[model samples]
Every structure is written in structure tokens, then in C-alpha cells.
Target: MTHRGAEPPDGTGFLAVRCDVTDSRQVDRAFEEAEAAHGPVTVLIANAGVTHDRLLPLMREEDFTSVVDTNLTGAFRVARRAARGMLRVGHGRIVLVSSTAALHGAAGQSNYAAAKAGLVGLARSLTREFGPRDITCNVVAPGLTDTDMARALTPEQQSELLRRTPAGRAAHPDEVAEAVAFLAGAGYVRGAVIPVDGGAGLGH
Candidate 1:
């Protein structure tokens, strides 16, 4: 697949790089390389993630730390770098990939939920600090998505999730990606968290 830049279907101005979000060396190198290829990172999508699920009392230290390192600290690394560029240029987009668990609280996902929830605050804080510079920071909270990650679940679990979801099915990853793309494109929008959860957790 493509990794460096977007073609006609995607756009003229884009550079896509695969990076380990948890690693500072990789993040620095990737951003440096991407900036060289496509100018500064005007739009940042911190979507790198992983799951280490287990009940809190039964969970190991590594499990909790790993998820926190990747989901929370990882996004922070990328966003911090991107924000620096955005603040300097006086314009940018920072759309974080959060989760419905961030709000609803997953039974065996304390680490994941806490990490994702932190992103909302992080995005909002940036919005206040950088809004005058035309930088918009937002979050997209996706529900059960029909990705390899969800497909790995038992068939019964998948079916039950579909039953609970108002749309009666899992969402395509592109569906969530669309929300992120929207926030990226809309210059005036900032500090917003859009839930792409098919009405699964329309909280109070």
C-alpha cells in the first residue's frame, strides 16, 4: 500500500507515514521526514492504538502501563509536536481518535477508557490556547467498529453489540474517519467531540 503521500483520489498535499506512536525517536523522525516531504504537518490525526483488556483487580502492571503509554502518552507526543508547528503557522487541524468507552466506561478497559477520556481534555485545552491562531482541535469517539480489532471478538459478542447499537451493526472504519476528516476540513470548528457510535451510548 501507499505510505509516503496521497495521490489523486486522496489529495495533492498529503504525506502518510507509519510510526510507532509510543516511541519518541520514531515520532520525531517520522514528523521530520513528513515535514520534509509535505511541508509542516498542518493536520494531525493521532490514531495509533492498542488494547490490553482485563478487569482492574485481575490486570497486570504491564497491561495497564502499555495501554496508557500507547493510547495516551503516544497521542500526546504527536499532538505536542503538531501543535508547535500549528501555533507557529497560525493554522492547523488536530483530530484525536477517542472511543465511546472514554465516556461509557468499559467493564474491563480501565486503562483504555482513562486514556481516551484524557484526549478530550487535551484537545479542548489546545483549542483555548490555539484558537486565536486558527488551529482547531477535536475528538472523534467511535463505537464498535467492524475492524480486525472487533472482528477478533466472539461471534456472540459481536451479535450482542449489533443488537444494542441503534444502527444494528458495527461501523466501518471509514465512517469514523469521515468524522475526523470533517473536523480537519472545517476551519472554524474546535474543541468538539463527535461520537460516531450509531446511538449506542447517547449519554446524559
Candidate 2:
């Protein structure tokens, strides 16, 4: 999962490893390591994702499956494990990072859209299962953020995004982070998909 990209903390508290979220073993290791040190995950942010933006006819089978596995099922892997701990502790938070494509269709992004859309269902299911235990689950869908991943757009593509988006520009990564932060900390929000799309995905 992507973080703030800031350097590691000077205090050297928790150990964060580079893990492929789709791989169950790696997901397990992340929890094990974090638990071995700090504690069972009290809060989880399922932000793992990937994109394979080829047209459907040209997109490889692996491209499609990989996106689903990483972006959707990967969140499940962490949630299932973390739920066990959260259940035992009786309180937790889970924020699944989705995308505006989950609600709005986009050309050449079928795989991404499907995976992201699935997160909404996942979040809702978690809320139903865990909300009574005080474990809130929600989704945060970010729009076109001005990160390296978004800047990959061609000039025309970027221009089209600006024109279509009521905000008139792409969002900053920090803005998306703020959405995640609020829902993660809020006490009542559950099974909601908070969009940080600057009105690009409004009315969806």
C-alpha cells in the first residue's frame, strides 16, 4: 500500500515491509511483523492497487486478473485477518482506498473499474459484519490526483480531465489522504464511499 512517501520515522517504531498485497503470505507477514512489534492492527487502510490501461481487445488476460486480485481481493486478505484481531479487541477501523472509476466508467480502464467497484461491496460487507463491534469500514475514492501515476496521462488526456472535472484540475495526493484520515478517525461513518474527486465524479 502507498503511504505518504515520507521518509521512515526517526523513532523506528513499526517495521513496514514491501509486500505484494495479493499474495497471502506477504499479507500475513505484514500483520505478523506489525503485531510482533507494536500490536494487532487497530486500524487498516487497504490501499493496494494497480492499473492495466489497455483497450479490452488488447489487454492481456493476466492484466485483467492481476488488477482484480491486487485491488479487490488483496483488501479482503488483510480485512479477513485484521477482523479476527479487531473482533478480539472490540474496536478497529478499516478504510479501503478505491477510485472514482468505481462509480464512473472510463475507457480503457475496465479492469481497474471492476476492481475498484468491487471495493464498495467489500466495504459494505465489512460494515455489516463488524459495525456492531465498533469496527467501522468505509471506502475512499480518489479522482485524478497529480501524482506520478496520474501525470502519466498525455497532454490531451490531461486537458480532457481538466475540462470534464468541475474542479478544473487534478487533486493532490494530500487531499485524498485527508479524506481517508477523516473517515478513519470518525466514529459514526460506515459503509460509505467518500469521493475525493473535486467534483469530477459528482452526481455519481
Candidate 3:
């Protein structure tokens, strides 16, 4: 998901380009197409991710690498390409979607957690390198959300999760989107980890 606009006179809306972050070629082409339609990408939301949860003893090496490649390295690939255009224009906003598990840890999601945590480092480095050029980078860490992903949990499981969350409920997807929008619109904020986790990751 990405946003690029300042509410046009008619408020038409944004363009949605499908790009496979795992494929560098596809990522490059997506940007080219978007640029042709709108202009250089001024805001990018690197939200491509996948989860492969398994206990460490049972986790296959392929599972770990695959998640990291798509979630962590995939963001790197897309961000690297997007930075080219942003640097040329001298302004941009980069918001990467991470997970609460990145900080709190999950029972069977070591790979996913590690990959998400990597985004924090990536955003910070980008902030340092691009901040001087009027670009900002940040992370949005979401907790359990009312999405297909959250539906995977059973009723009992969902209840258990809510019991632990201070909000006592799953977040609506729009709630997460709102945070991303705020970061995209903010110019002064840079390299910040803004968690929409319902206070689940307070200490971290």
C-alpha cells in the first residue's frame, strides 16, 4: 500500500500498482508505471510481508529465509529502488509496516519477528541518510487486527489474545491505515517507530 497525493481539487483518489517486492525487477517496473501515471513516487509504503511460523526446533531453514527475504530484504529492495526517485526529487515519505511481534516476541514466529525488527534498523538508517534531503522514514507496528490474517485464530484464541491486549479487542484495519497516513503526511517525524499495538508493546 502507498499514498501519493495532497487531496486534489476533485479528490479523485490514489493509484494502486501491484508489485511483488520479492522480485526486484517487478518492483522497478511498478515504480516506472506509477511514475508515468502520477510522477516520481513521493511516498512509499513498503507493506509486503509473509509469515511462516514454526517452533525453532521444527522451523525449516527455508521457512526462515523465505520470510526474511520477503518481509525484510523485500522491503530493502523496494526501498532502495524508491529512494532513487525520491533522492532525485529531494523529498519523500517512507512508511514501513511492521508487527508488534517484532518487539514482544511470539510463540512460533521467530522468523517473522526478526524480519519485522529489521525494518526498525532499516528505517533508522534511511532517516539518517535521507533526512537531510527532506525525506522521512518510519515504521508502523500493528498488533492483532481484524483481517484475514487475524481470522486464522479460533474464537478461543482470539479471546485469549484480546485478554492480553489492553484494548481488549482486535484493531480495525482502518486504524492501522490511519497511522500510516499520519506518518506519510508528517514532515518533521523521521525514523520513528509508531506502534498501533493497543499498548501491547509498551515497554519496548
Candidate achieving the largest TM-score: 2
| TM agreement with the true structure for every prediction | 0.89, 0.91, 0.90
- Stretches > 4 Å off in candidate 1: 1-16
Better of 1 and 3 by TM-score: 3
lDDT string for model 2 (95-123, tens) is 99999888987788899999999999999
Candidate 2 segments exceeding 4 Å error: 1-14
Q: For residues 133-164, what per-residue lDDT tens digits would candidate 3 score against the true structure?
A: 88999999999999877787668767867877
What's the candidate order when arranged by decreasing TM-score? 2, 3, 1
lDDT of 1 by residue, 26-127 (tens): 788888888888777898888877788799899999998899898889889998988777777888998888998898887788989999999999989988
Better of 1 and 2 by TM-score: 2
All candidates: CA RMSD in angstroms? 3.5, 2.6, 4.5
Model 3, residue 81: C-alpha shift (Å): 0.8
TM-score of 2: 0.91
Off by over 4 Å in 3: 1-13, 154-157
lDDT of each: 0.83, 0.84, 0.86
